[model samples]
Target: MGASIDERKPMVSGFGYASHSSSGIGSAHFRGRGRSHAPFKTWIWRHWPLLMVGSFGAFYLIHRLSHMGSSTSAPKATSQSAQQLRSDSSRVQNGKVRLSDLIGASIHLSEVAAHEITDVKFGGKEATEVKGKTDEGVDEPVTLADARSNSVFVNGLRELFPGISILSEETDPDLEEVGISAINGVELTHDPWLDLNDILITVDPLDATKEFTENLLHFVTTMVCVVHKGKPIAGIINEPFVKDEAAVWGVALDKATEGADLRVSHGLQPSTEDTVAGADKVVISRSHTGSGADVVSEYLPGKQPVFAGGSGYKALRVLEGDANAYVHVTKIKSWDVCAADAVVHAAGGEFTNLKGERLVYEKDDPMISGGIIAAADSKMHAWYVEKLAPLQSSHGDKHRI
Candidate 1:
């Protein structure tokens, strides 16, 4: 559900005024007031124009003087604000905090949802169940954690960015209360600077639910991606199981002009060094490796593929250069990969489908039928796509739905 341009008038404050029609405040209004002083009233009536002009002149002069004072002091204030911003930006190790200030509430919302998934304990069989199969024919499960976290994400995003469109995986109205109550006690920051026109916000309140149910907490994540005109511009991935400040966020700060580059930063950790040695490594899905092994064998040759769960995690493996590339030749969803795609691209990495085409995040359909291939750099990505495209087209044709 994407918003149209006409419905996206930002709710920020600006200069405005209320006008009153003179007919509503005419002589009839003055007559109701005590007017016993006839001599004064007569004199005032005759001299009213002169008195009004003098009063206007005096007020105008005072207004100009006040404005002059403000003009004189404005630069210093502006300079101080600019200096403070720079000082704040300098402390960031990975992500551009300044550019992401507009989406602070979303980042916080993802973290809140993540923490709820890990920190809260569920009761009985109510905690988990096999929900249904995904478009890719994988058995997807829905957990109390998933529902509650999704509720928080959906409700919180709606509250913070009412004008922006939202798409969440779990939209059952009955389950909303599980997470909506949590938001009442939370206080999140808001920034009114980002343009909301034609923006679509997608959320994966809980990813790797099967891993979570199995107590494999490391792979579980809460994700949010901001898509503008079919491109992901900002993304946040929160690992609730990670110790402290377990979030990694990225913003395509220059997306309007150059959407390819992104500024990525860890929540509080330093940027990890490229530990990848001469022998290349590839990462693929642990649970659903459909055609991934064949892809690595046919395209990567000598490289051994490492298995992992969660698209966000696999993308990070490539982002950290622990793996040279990540390839998947099965169906996937926009919410599962959009945040990771933004982060990898922001850091100057490359992400595209097996056909060597950039994935479009149109809100009308969340399914990305072509699958994905992400790499730490452009050359490595090209290397994989050149070898794998034909094989992918031949075997994974159903994925092209």
Candidate 2:
């Protein structure tokens, strides 16, 4: 009785003793019979550390996720910024072109190095003024010292043009210097050109210097012309010794006369003196050619054929409207065409190869040649080609870009 009372006293002190025995834990029927998924008291003891660790892990995962998101977004933002910058640059370039009729206000290439005396650094020992032949047969390379003289012009143009690429008989720098895109500002380009836009200046600075020295014709100086789209727009051939006694003119495309300059403005109206395709004018070269000139004779019968030295001087007389077309049957590279081409293009004219295809600038090859055909007006060009088409195709269209 005393012992039972002692056990009963312990039970009463704890509110009550549990009725289930230790065996109750093993019975399947007793499992989860009357309890929640987890009772507060037992769960607290068994999983306190697990709950704390899980809470910290969830917070760390969220924080790490945010940092990762920021990292991924950074490059995308940078790419978008670059795109916007490029778009803005394009707009600026287009605006510059639209606001003005000319790329720059009246760029007369003749004024840049127009009358500079061309030193005779070369004279082709084999340069012949007679009939010759090419791939089509009987074509001739000017075979003169034009190559050595090409170096001085190449160097001079580099000085004059600054960062623009050079295309001469002696050197052919790629257009990569100006960037592939024309719409991009030259200021932004790795290299800036003396003339902007697609305009490329070409010159055969001393075409017939050897012929001039040997022939004693004093009417030759540096050849000056701008070749655009592989054609002459405006050209100036200054007789270095003559002191501004040179001719400057170019063909007029649409609106060529709209923004008139002192030179072409006077030429817009055909003066009795500057008229081409007329009588009483002489077409000649100081370095004479019979076959090439014969082709010209068919167009201008009995027109006096004058002999002028230097390629620029010969081509210039045509620009002045003092003469008709000058046909170069030799292989002329970029340098031979660029200077006069720039001026001619500005003057609103077109220059082309004998095939009537446009002349392109900056070729990799230096020695390549196709014949050149210079005309006064772009519209009148086809008429001349109609006359020369036979010469172009029959001669194998050897015109190079």
Candidate 3:
């Protein structure tokens, strides 16, 4: 007992001293060394981080392993109230997503198809309406309520996740809609309600419209998701026009329908030049509404360049070895990039600010407005980031997250 106490004394001293040095450890409940588990102080003191990491790792491993098993052995559903898929039963006009089918699944274009039976027109007043301002004085016009009701393009997604906050520039309850009725319990309604506890879903109904109107490759919708605590959980941006699943654009339509179409890249590839060499003579905006062109032009000093549509589409171009990189100098709404971000991250490309820092999600700012530098090639990415970092520093206009 004395030996055990002696060994643990250093840890106790360390904790007490650290806490004292920093100030009262704010609402921290030390689990193992508390009164009931006091005897385990020695074990807990040295292994706090290890335990936490191991616990999370174990849970993830178990979740993945259990996925191979049948539903009979799966854990019981927890978020019951939101699981009932209220949107499907209320699918009057179009764009109905059966939430029961989409949650926990990777964001895929086919998932959009499952609800596309509702024939939802993605961009309307719900998408184009000017809603409000973001944190850094950048303008924001998310359509959250419209997503819950009228458009499966957005509303179907709301039905997918239970506690998530989706900031959609289109279909948000904040604005009026001609055909769709609203869902109950969600914070937004035609009456103007607020539910801060739920996760935020920020989306742009139609990204890159100029490209779409001009008959570009595809006009995609931007969708980004954040949990209540302000972390980016997932992102999806689907082509509103091109049924990527119809052809070989994204997944094999046959494979995608079975929920096996999620494409995740490991990390930035070693060389983008060889991969994308001579594939096409054009580059375009991933979103049709069109942005970042002037910023992209900044990268090309004298080249007569081309542009495409949608945030995800741009990132995917790099992954498919098409474009070398994607450079954005302005703040973009979260929904515009979130869904496609999953594809880019899965494709193994790298995304960051000019400083090479990862972009994070925040609740208060509906649009995760910031400049981005994405690359298919590490060397190419590094060169561009290093070159632009100085400019970003000099300008002092880039927002952190």
User: How much lDDT does each candidate structure score?
Assistant: 0.65, 0.43, 0.45
Tens digit of per-residue lDDT, candidate 3, span 302-322? 322346656766765666666
Deviating ranges (above 4 Å) for candidate 3: 1-150, 157-163, 171-200, 213-217, 221-229, 243-271, 278-304, 395-401
Per-model TM values vs. the true structure = 0.66, 0.46, 0.49
- Worst 10-residue lDDT window, candidate 2: 9-18
| Highest-scoring model, TM-score | 1
lDDT of 2 by residue, 1-401 (tens): 23332232111111122222334422111224566756545744675666566567667877887888455412211221212212211222322232121222112222333323333223234344433443335433442334434434443333223333334442332111111122211111112122334444455545544545455445544554444343444444445445545334443332342233322422333222334453245444434456556666765444556655555555455555765555666665565555455444444445577567766564344343556666556665565566666665555443221
For model 3, the local distance difference test gives 0.45
Give the better candidate number (2 or 3) by TM-score: 3
Q: Write candidate 1's Cα lDDT for 230-348 as tens digits.
A: 88777788888877755777765453543333455554222224355523777888766655666677666788878888888788777765677888877788889998887777677
